[model samples]
Target: MSILAIKHGIWKVAGEEVRQVKQVTLDSEFELEEIIQSNPAILQDNWLIIGRQVMTVYNTYIDLLAIDNNGSIIIIELKKHKTNREVVAQGLDYASWVKTLSPSQISTIYDDYVSRYYENQNTLEEEYYEKFRIQLEEESINNSHQIVIVASEMDSSTERIVEYLSDSLIPINVIFFTVFEENSTKFISRAWMIDPQETLENATNSVRDKEPWNGEYYVSFGDENNRSWIDALKYGFISGGGGEWYSRTLNQLSVGDRVWVNIPKVGYVGVGTVADTAKKADEVFFNDIDGEKKSIYKLSKNAKYHEEYLEDGINAEYIVKVNWLKAMTENNAASEIGFFGNQNTVCKPRASKWVHTVNRLKEIWQIK
Candidate 1:
């Protein structure tokens, strides 16, 4: 898409209106490359630049390589003019090589890159853990990779090729960056030809090689000091806090949905069905052993603080009532290596890792 800038100027004659449109140009491809390399977040957030002009076994070079928050590798190729017909094939070639890179090899690439260009001396392992908020395992890294084609414009054939690849569940997309100039000021805007998140979901589902979703969700019960697994089990609920960023996603869980609960840094603690949609803690009620329904604040002393935040508004801890099918204490929480646990409080994860985590939990808990 083209970026147009409208100019308003004094008319040469009365009652005459004149509008001028201006176009901006990049003097060289290096300008586009430098801006992206310096600020990768402009393309997407939480992306750690792994390498640039990185050479492969075939003696070809990749424009840029990055890793995202989900520990997936990103291959970014840029073009100043129309994307070439061979760009798609070149991207696939780089991806083929990238898929075989072990975690150590990826780290070495990042380390060498930093030593040559960056000021900080942090290792890739440290940055990976920091960016993703989880430790790195060699086998777990690069389970899937994505291709991003960035350019000023793309020909119809190139667009069709990319769309065809994506339709086949390949994680590839084109992002167009348009430039505009007015009064010696420059502006750049971005647009994605295909929805990136949708492509990612398609890619994730394709990689899992699993059936369609069974309508169950995986929810993490976070901030133990504010919500306890014991209390959640006793009250038949799950909770989240630390503001709307953490708690807002809880709204995605609806009544009648199945939920598998996990405690971060621990393991899967319980599996349950949602009995009620999410609400502020004070509004949450659960049936006690005596068959009496009471607000969770009365059942758990720690939950009382959630009531205080009710008046504070928006920052209050949110609760979703659950009908526990089976549960274990934090000490006995079932865990295995490579178990899936996202930092989000609630999510409908379709990744194979989530499926594996649930299968393992079922076997450990002996759920029929």
Candidate 2:
């Protein structure tokens, strides 16, 4: 993508009158590596770089190592003057090593990296909770991994190969970064070879050689303060808000989809069929005490919801209607050992734990 500057009511190159901004060549791939090391968000907003130039069993160094909120490792291998095929192969090789890593081994790797890179640091578990606000599951770490090939550009053959690997559920992708220079300033733009969301979906499917998805979704209902679980249970709707990220996943719920809602630290509280797609807080209505349809935001008992609704100018509360198969208050919620949980507002989980959880909940809730 080209970067253009609008100046004096005319679109032109950032630095020049009529010429477009020119792409600049990095002196070395290490320069690019350092940039990403400083801020991995340029590649993925949710990723935390755990190791830089991490060494493998074969004695070769990986360009970078990162972990996402889902506890999946990311193998980032820079092209770095290597041929496209070579970089792809290297990334795969590193992934092979990464998949073999146990939770303890991963912690050791992080300890080594921090000792070498930072003056002081918390344990990976602490840092992970601080960064993602969710406890890291050691057993779940590295259940799946992704290979990332970073390059300035990819040839047609490289692109085709990447596409084929992605199509086959290999969880591999290429990121192309272009550097532009103008007026002694440098700018970087990144583009993914395949849509990252599609890649993630493929990775989720490929995880643990799992069985097919059971067409059910997991919803984490953590906003009990703003949107009361009692209110939701009475009103026949699930709501999320506070930010776009918190509410965006609600879009995945459509009419007739099966959803199992968990109350984060509480437990599984409800299983229901989605009755309607998501709507804004002001647009969603439910029967009030007098049996009159009233906007959920105007309900006095849900004062926190109304407060957040009025204050969240950009990302207002969104609610999805649900027809309850079975619902319960938090006091009556059900949970046991090994129940699947995630930080995402909504997720189509492919883990074996998810299947087991759903089956167990069915038995507990007496759902046929």
Candidate 3:
């Protein structure tokens, strides 16, 4: 509390002498965006992408052109003093222009940029061309996309850009970073990249703000008592496996026939008919499953389908509608086939149980 005590406290805190190694400079404190700006390898050393500044396009040359490891162009807009919300529009503009370029045009752009820098950058063109050839063969290069925003602080430039992008329904990210000051110590620095949207969403609003969940919640009013989801489930299952041999082929059922196969380990496999005939390929798709691709298949006999499913009192009440809400509660039922799985390892709730469960939810919600 005294002056002498305060001075002693200050001295104690600064007791150590500044070391010579403290003067060494390093870029370790830069965020991902800034890192890429200096050394593109912050991503990886893939030639499919190269960092460059465009001479003829938007007055702004990009901080990084993070192309796909193959050829899909990933336009990166980096901000050192700003945030992504600042440059999304400009980045989008560049993306639009880049998308319009043909393979030849793209090569020319690369060549043009190259010619200015490399004496014989024509060689880079061939290498890129060969890489593109491989990418096409591998079924890559769907489209060039992806927005990146990086900065230690989101300034007015960043906020303006983010608001505009959000209003335009442009899916872009605002990567916030905490830039640290250099300390008189050995080579060590720290920085961070955080999602700005998440931070904003978590912040309290002064007036009427929207729900934090956004649209991720159920679109259709979730009526815990509604039996409609049950009906939807029953209709989902197309029954009638033709025979036993069908289960072996994973399609022992003929087209147009709905068959359920019982896997002792994984439960029943169901497939609905999309075609008709012995050779007709099974649509083999699932009705409703999440986190997987579920498909139904044609079968020979409904017995084979039921053989595995029917046990004890399960089929006693016809199970016209099951308490799917209950089943889901008992089990992790966030998937399309939250109730069950079809072939292709996809989830397809059993027709009877699925429908019944849906209705049960309606029942609980008392909607229908």
Candidate 4:
């Protein structure tokens, strides 16, 4: 693929334009690694860096190792002077060993890495919870792993291999990062050999093997400081941040859909049926004990603040009404060492961990 930039000139050359596109080489693989290390968010929002230059029992080194919000491991390999086949083989070799790692062993690896590179930072367990907003347990870690090959350029043979592997339902991919320089300004662009979301769906479907989706969904209530869980439970609703990025997922729920509610740092607190789809907070109303209906703002102080904030129109809280069937205070939230929770405010989870979480919650709440 070719990248081009159009340069605008002054009045003397009003109708003329200059196209300058220069391919730039990174000073070294170390520099490329430093750029990715400083901002793993560039790869994806869900990825949390575990360590750089991780070592395996086989005595080979992994370029970078990370974990996504769903507790799946991500192994990233950078291509320097090696042939495409060699780099791909090396990544696969690391993944073979990674797949065998038990959760406890993975944590140990992360701990050792932290001791070496981040001595003053929190322990691996603490950092895991802080980054993902959910507790990490040995059994819940590394259910599956993904392999990412990073290179400045990919040859046709490498691209073909990547496509074959991804189409075969293997969780492997290639991400090409091109550095370009124009007039002393530098820019980096990225492209994936296979669409990221499509690859994930294919991998997920292969794993599911035709298993039907459970009718339930998982929802993470926003942090307590912004939206009160007590208010949510008392008023029979759930809310997300005042931005569309946070609240748009709520649109996936419709009236009569059942959802499991979780509080970050806490656990699964309630199971409820959607009474209505998402709406602006100011538009929602709840019935009072006196049997009179009042706008949510009039009932909950938090709702009043949300309403006040929504007046600006830029960041307005969004709410989804729910009819709580089983509810508990944060102190009694239902969670075990292996229960599943995600950073997403609303998600329809189909992973085995989600199944385990729902089954356990059923026993705890005694719901049919």
| Candidate 4 structure quality by residue, lDDT tens digits, 140-195 | 47766788888877777877787787766677887778777777876777777776
Q: For residues 1-368, what per-residue lDDT tens digits would candidate 3 score against the true structure?
A: 00111011011133576423223333543445445545543432332444456543656676556444334555666564443444656666776666565555555556665566456564444655564322232222313344555444455665655555544334344544332223543332222232322221222110122222211101111112211222223334222222221122222224343322222123222222323322212333434434454322222211223333334222111111111221222122233333322221111232343444344434543533
User: After superposing candidate 1, which stretches have Cα over 4 Å from the reference?
Assistant: 1-23, 81-84, 130-133, 202-212, 220-255, 274-324, 337-356, 363-368
Better of 1 and 2 by lDDT: 2
Candidate 3 Cα outliers beyond 4 Å, as residue runs: 1-38, 43-48, 56-60, 80-86, 113-142, 155-169, 176-368
* Positional deviation of residue 59's Cα in model 1 after best superposition, in angstroms: 1.6
Against the reference, the lDDT scores of all candidates come to: 0.74, 0.81, 0.36, 0.76
**1 or 4: which has the higher lDDT?**
4
Q: What's the CA error at residue 286 for candidate 2, in Å?
A: 4.6
lDDT for model 4 comes to 0.76
Worst-scoring 10-residue span by lDDT in model 2: 1-10
lDDT of 1 by residue, 1-368 (tens): 21222222222233575554365777777788888888886787657888989989999888899987556789998864434667777888888899889888888889888988889978877878776556666655676789888876777788878778787778888777767676777666677778665455554454546455656687877635577777888778888865654677788787888889888778888998889888888777777778887877777775443565877557788888888889888888888887876655776666666777778777887875
Q: Which candidate, 1 or 3, has the higher lDDT?
A: 1
Ranking by lDDT: 2, 4, 1, 3
lDDT of 2 at 29: 91
lDDT of 2 by residue, 185-293 (tens): 8888888777665566566665555656889999988745577888788888887776665677788888999999999778999999999998887888888788898
Off by over 4 Å in 2: 1-19, 223-228, 239-247, 279-318
Cα shift from native, residue 140, model 1 (Å): 2.4
Q: How far is candidate 2 from the true structure (C-alpha RMSD, Å)?
A: 4.9
